[model samples]
Target: MLVETVTLQIPEILYQRLVNTARATQRPLEEVILHALQTGSPPEWDDVPEEFQADLAALDKLDENTLWQIANSGKTSAEMERYNTLLEGNSSGTLTEAERLELMALRHEADLFMLKKTQAAVLLRWRGHRVPTP
Candidate 1:
């Protein structure tokens, strides 16, 4: 296949580093640049610098909550609106210190209530009784 050549004027520091990398890896500078461009993100394949490998490896171990929305993915539009409202109310600075403390207490109590309900539902299911919640 015929390949087209395109010229890019990169900063001298970056160009020097790319050339040094090519020499170290025993790959053509043009090939290294092309591979890096194709990857769009560095550390995709053979052209990544050794200095970045450790940081890249660390990124590979991100948890689902950090990388993907798992629990909140199933929320409907109405549920999302309600959640957002609660968050807004809780975060608003207009609340006095006493009101803020009360809000925090209410949030904590709601969380514990939900936890108990979930446990009860699970137990009911195990005992062959239908438990319903939305």
Candidate 2:
């Protein structure tokens, strides 16, 4: 990995917190600061499943407005109605093959939607926005 060095200042309290953490963890201050920098920025998603990694990686480059939009967006009413109907059919074990395939596709889309929203919120919070709890 390429490394770059930049000089910067931090609040005294924040510096103190980093120093304290380093001491507690028996690590050098630089190591602690590097870890903090990496963690405080958008995630690398190393431990996440491969399926979710690409979506999350893309979010890291998005601007704040785009991230906020993603964080707040949800399903259309029509999509929600269809998804719910499919779920009901699934629960009752009455789905035809076509409906079953539709449900599977819808479920995957729903999963991706939720993952994007969550990642957007996390990035917004990390960027120091006041993300309200829902």
Candidate 3:
């Protein structure tokens, strides 16, 4: 792939830390910085406010909601087709309530995956990883 070079300004301490990390991992400085850039958190905030911070339990809830939104994007017709396919595959009797709920959840997750893909593409462009088309 054709790549473009860009310069970044970071604090001396952070630069030294990156160098140390690269040495420890036996990787180049560029590689270490690139890895950090890819894994870094979204740039919505420099630091989150204490009041807005959600604990692990809240994070679980947020994840569950995100999954539900993704999975339920299919319309009624699509859902029926999915249900029929499942029934066809499982010739070993009726589905339990919990099993049925799980299938619905999976469908919802399928919907969210599309949104996540778009999000990743946008982020990549913002981070200069991918060239954005005009």
Top-scoring candidate (lDDT): 2
Tens digits of per-residue lDDT for model 1, 1-134: 99887877887755764565465446687876776676432223223445443433332233323222221224368755755565676677566666667666656545544443443343333323354555
Which of the predicted structures, 1 or 3, would earn the higher lDDT when compared with the native? 3
* Candidate 3 structure quality by residue, lDDT tens digits, 1-134: 99789988998755765665455446688886787688762222113434333221122222323423433443478767776676654556577777667666765554444444344343343333543333
Q: How does residue 126 of candidate 3 score in lDDT? A: 34
lDDT tens digits, residue span 4-99, model 2: 999989987567656654554466888868877877633445467788777876776666788899999988999999999999999999999999
Worst 10 residues of 3 by lDDT: 54-63
lDDT of 2: 0.77
Global fold similarity of model 2 (TM-score)? 0.69
Model 2 regions more than 4 Å off? 1-41
Clash count list over all predictions? 0, 0, 7
- Candidate 2 pairs with clashing backbones: none
Please give each candidate's TM-score: 0.33, 0.69, 0.30
